[model samples]
Target: MNETYDKRIMKQKTHRLLEAIAALIISAIIALIFSFLVSVLSSSQVYAQRVAGREGLYRDSVYRRVIGQGSTSLSCYLSYPQGGSSVLRGYGHNAYELGKLGEFIRAALSDTLIYVRSVRVCGYCSVDGNYTSNEQLARKRSLGFMQFILSEYPFLRRYGIRADWVGEDWDQLRSLVASSTLNERDEILQIIDRVDIFSGREKLLMDLNGGAPYRMMEQLFFPLLRRVELTVEYDLHRIIEERYRRKLNDREFALLLEQEREKVRREERLLAEQRALKEKWQADSLAVEETARAQQARAQQAGAQESARRADEAAAAAYRRRREAAREASAARTEHRKLYPLWGVKTNLYALAGLTPQGERTTFMPNLEIEYFAFGRWSLSASALYAYWDFAQGEFWGVTSYTLEPRFWFSPTGLCRGLYTGLYARTGDFDIRRSVVEGVPTDNRTGTYYEAGASLGYVLPLSRHWYLEAGVSGGYRRVADKVYDVEQDKHYLVRNQSQSRLRLTDIRLNIGYRLGKKTIK
Candidate 1:
């Protein structure tokens, strides 16, 4: 009786152990499936949509507050940072130095908040017709300031900073006259309104002190502003986000922060370099101007005496013109040289319509190509081709192929006026379409073709470093195909050949563009 009781107890223990193991396996499977469902649901959430909707509302409110109908006109001084210039201020270091102030204004604008979409920075001087009054000089100063910012901080490119020259604001003279006492008016001093204007954002940076009620109306408020200022209309929330908000970390948050900090430091260093270079340039320019003035004065004194040497003077003038032209051309070529080679892909949509000796066929061929230039005048390319066609309305067929052609070219001193030419060899597959003459399926022959060719082309550059290309070429080709027996046995194979070798005449006309780099190797 005791032995039988022990056996029953062992059986119950074994069954319990098996049941526990099964339960664990089921729990693990359930956990995995639940996790997958949670992930899928979370991924489909419209978090970005919600954030964008909130941002839109925030923008509208900011705009109304910044520039409203009831807002009174206030005068503000436009203080441009000293030493700024434009990109086109005669080729030299001073070019950027003259436009630095414009750079500062460009950097500070926020498209999302301030709505400062466009800015025109103008530089003017006090002199009526003196050196300072030269429109080009002031213009250069404005442009110099613009270029400095653009070169140092590429972000300013997004703000669209432009520069111009309006030597003096004569319209404001009447206002200045009205506000000045009779004796003070005799001082011949100029009064300018300094209002940096931005669209859509009403940001009040300055306030006019007590003055004539019509004082703001008569003379322009910000004409003589030496510095750069922005006129803006903005939303309050956007301003807050732009000025104070922080972005949430998705992952490796520390890495992102480090990257941002590095970028900031790099920009700061570039700005400092720009400032130092500009200061030196400004000093140099001032000295050059002083020397030029002295020379002009001396020339005037010698004007009468030099008349007998007219030929020499004429020669000197011609030499100066030639020198100027050469300088401009050299500058253009330097600008055209890109740091990297041109890289782009091409897709050809090909259609062929012709009556062959056998029948009429319409074909569509697709060509895909990828090309890259290794460096100065050297390039490599690869391409794939595919075609599908039907002939005689039910008689004949189609093919797919890939071809890779690599070649090298060189520009020989004066070949085609500084252009280049190259010779290339190509090999690829050619396929025949399916056809049925009797109630039997016909064989589709696959063949290989080899061709060699040469091409001549010229790169014609347009305004702003854009290029137009044209070329021509010719080559020879050979093809062969294989035939199989009806029984489809490996040992039963035959080759059929017709028009296997031929001299080919190929002519090509191409129009394309290059971007990112001028030289494609």
Candidate 2:
């Protein structure tokens, strides 16, 4: 009997070994296939370098000539310097030209979106003629030009273009001078070979050296190289999609209409207030003037009336006080200027309640959240959460977890005030312990899980920097396989070890403080 049992065990062990090997082989094959697919996809991608070179080369050739033709086809519109020779000499001019360039760009893009990847606009002039230091003149010319474009055109505002006031690469300056002489083009190219602009060590390491510096043809062509070149960058697909989809969101559309109506109402109220104040001030002024006239008449008629002088002083004091009060009220109305046009940060602390081991809802626990604002007023936040529930009758009870969530907040008013609702999906790891089973210590375990839920809340300001917020949030949480154990028998047959899924339903009350400016009315 012993011999037969040993044989059976050996045969089972052999079969188990074969199964393990087969599983390993299958896993390797799948991994290899996945890697192959990734490589193929990566090779087909239009990466930054390729796009830059293709677009840069074409613009250097075509756009330069187009500008030479006097159509301003390759310039960014300027807005800041208003208009001047200074504006014309700097990035300001380039910024102005951008709008015109944009029209051609739009046509070129067709259905595609355009993104300005990068713009380096540098302006240079002969240092000999200017009264200012060459560097100082260059800086002023750069800034003046930038300001001109900024003041003239609002379109360049989209690119977030900023000028370098005192930046110069002397090497490039020399290269510019050298390349300007017709006889020295090839000689300058030879000298530039030792320069690191195009063929740097890092570029060589990456096998991306294009092996040449870009020279503006105008300096080599006609009157002068005294100009600013604005490099416009964009991804055709991205810009097209963005422009096409730019629309008022439902809430924003509604809020805009609401704001217009409110504006009209406020204007009417302001007009009424102004009229009332004006009439009151006018009447008071007339009374004071008449009294003064009467007092002066009396003074001329009979020596002096001290009482009349005192009344005149009191009237002046009252008028000053009234003006001061009006100014204070105006300040209160407009003080909370929106700092960020489209971004806000919020911190929230909530008291949490959870079920106990015995199946009773426990008292409040603590939770906190730090959130980031994303596109379309949506937010993604991470939270540290704790839930403890005790029940009088059930065996399972207790959980403490942390979750990362991508949250979407819908503010019906388009302003994050009053009634706002959010839907959040959270997933993370957690540690939990079951109530001591049979009076023995329960083992502590860990697992990864996910939760989904929605929350409704209202933010009401009680003061400029403080607000009272309350909301009810509920979610379904699923905890998977806290622990798994596999055992192999003497015959090498794998035995079922352990596995379980824990699902918890949570409904909690939360009250929080909003730490920021004036409460939204």
lDDT of 2 by residue, 469-512 (tens): 55555567665633312123222222223333434333433332
lDDT of 2: 0.45
Error of 2 at 114 (Å): 55
Where is model 2 poorest over a 10-residue stretch in terms of lDDT? 48-57
lDDT of each: 0.43, 0.45
lDDT by residue (188-228, candidate 1, tens digit) is 23222232223211122112233332244334433443333
How good is model 2 by TM-score?
Answer: 0.28
